[model samples]
Target: MPNLPDPLPWPEAVAPDTTAFARQAILNLNRTIFGFELFDRSLAQGTHTSASDAALLFNVLSHAECEVLMQRKIIFINCTHDTLASGHLELVPPERVVLELPPLDAPQRDDVETHLMALTDIRRRGFRLAFDQSVLTEPHLSWRPLASFIKIDISHASESELSAWVQMARQNPKARLIAEKVETEAQFAMAQDLGFTLFQGYWFAKPILLSGKTVRPAQAAIIQLINLVRQQASTAQIEDVLKRDPTLSFNLLRFINSAGFGLKHEITSFRHAVMMLGLKKLFRWAALLLTTSQGAGTSPAVANLAVVRGRLMELLAADSLTPEECDNAFVVGVFSMLDTLLGMPLAQAIEAIALPDTVVDALLHKQGLLAPYLELTVACENADDAMFAKASATLKLSSQQVNWAHLQALSWTETLVD
Candidate 1:
């Protein structure tokens, strides 16, 4: 073969990873999520750089948690003039994300018109624009017509000031109003009354545990199947349980037939699927049912996190544990977030499903063979350097191994969630 040119070399160290700590400001209107505003959460006390914004986009859209957290929803991202020109915006799909730009100083006054011209070019390329309420004031007035959304900080604005802003927003019917830092019922109601289209801040995410809602039959049936798999029940025995729930059986067959399984032929019977998938995969599917099966008030956020943790823990357990123990590790990871999903205590939520004593101990008290795996998985998520070091040392794992597993889990979630 003829000599070929070498590919471009990879960077020495990964970028600072600012996106790992970014939290989503999930915006809502009338109980439905409108979009997510990803804010950088650097523990360091200083101003953010252009790199921070770039890292945020990469995490949300490129390689991090975007696919799961941003499923079919609009995303609001903070963009300074520096970030806008950094060329990272071109990497994302403009249709799904709204670029929230901050106010730029009109140093030469002509720069204002110049900046708008640049923004107009971006808008032509399919990206929508968002501006703060300050854009309603003097120098930004010329920029206001270009805004698709206007964010008002309700925390500091006076009553009359909010009224004026609201009036200004009404004048621009094309602009959607968003109220941020809304903390209480009064603020939420006031924002609603004032015609703000989207609301954000503490009040929106206040967890309301669902104690009144009963578990759906299909969900309960899935739980039964998971327990049966754990008990090492025969395929015939499990088939009888699935027979009672046609909906659950149909879902299993459909899932096996879907692209997720990569099967050559569609599975028409539960037994055939069990035999095709075998026990290991059958249990894996059962475990996924907890996350994917629709029910009342199950938080996709919790489900997605659980899936990542479960897969990471299972990967870490490779070569060190039995096949069955590895399966338990997966169970511990995915079900660990049950408390957040069910809106109850972990004990109560886990009680609804039957799991091994080892898995239960890991979930309940963090004391078992699988407990360290769960702890390490969580430490990975929180970026706790000390815990990660300690957990890896205890498990005889290296940072490189954990990082590789973490990336693999994120990739799997991207395919599974969307």
Candidate 2:
């Protein structure tokens, strides 16, 4: 991790508010959780930077892509202490949400009391309370009312410590146990034996390359169409490519007219859209469409997460680089997770996609102009401050900048998906 300069202020460009983003994020969460219960809270709202007026903000933020529609299970969401205290819980359906109590710290005694009071009230109303990141197994802590679920982390636990924790869980038969960071098959099996009903970890959603075979032929054609558009091919040439696939042509026309594009005139033909959007803009949008289309069978939240990463990286670099470079930064950010998105190897994905050398190097080799930036982004996502510091120092970025970028990522994600 290298030190970097202060993050630049947020850009004036506002992201569209749409339900599509939220649906995508929720779909992604579903895939990340294979058999265990999964829950979500906007990172921004969780940090208390914004108020969640809508209960479905989490769902909205998760579904920005078609991939989000693939999820089939229920996911719990956290309601902030403030929201609970304000009695907003009355407006929310308790059955759909699991109010998560903030961690108890020495300075938060009063806040904890208030939260507990709210939780008790809500539970009486048929809502459930969940305890997150519960590493403390003290008897005093254990005496607190049983939660609907308890989240535990074994990242730092020894075998003896884990066994003790498991024994403790057994002691509380009324509560459901969730093991987070179950990073290996062995860990997952152990958790299952411990009667843990839920799990989350990189092992379940490790980024991999997508083989061309996995992608439907229509999707592959869309990718080829995007490549042609990227080359500044003429409308006639682009139309010819699009005409080769009727399904894509129809979808493209529908998308262009939808509220997503807000086109004043309804364009019924693919060639007409190509002529109207011109080469550059057409290509940019085509790439987006292609990527999003691939999201149909995957988790939309994961795809939007990639988009958030790209937007944050680009915004962070806005002040230090040329517009062209900033665009490259955005490309580097989104494509950073291509392997995960494609369900293929990173090297293979890059080989298949004809991205610029800088983007290619950053994604595949992680040793080019944008590699450090990508590294910083990953560290931030994992909340590894030490790695963030190293990247900031190396990139000459300020802590404020880093913090701002992180916050913006959260904020942008909230707005885009929610």
Which structure among the candidates has the greatest TM-score?
1
Question: Which one wins on lDDT?
Answer: 1
lDDT of 2 by residue, 265-357 (tens): 799877788876676556555554544454444555456567667767777777777777777777777666666666666676556556778
The C-alpha RMSD in Å for every predicted model, in order, reads 7.4, 8.9
lDDT of each: 0.71, 0.58
- Which residue runs of candidate 1 sit more than 4 Å off their true CA positions? 1-47, 51-75, 85-97, 102-126, 132-143, 152-168, 178-208, 259-266, 297-329, 339-345, 356-411
Model 1 compared with the native: what TM-score? 0.67
Error of 1 at 199 (Å): 5.7
TM-score of each: 0.67, 0.64
| Residue range 140-197, candidate 1, lDDT tens digits | 7888888889989998777788989999877778989889877666787788888887
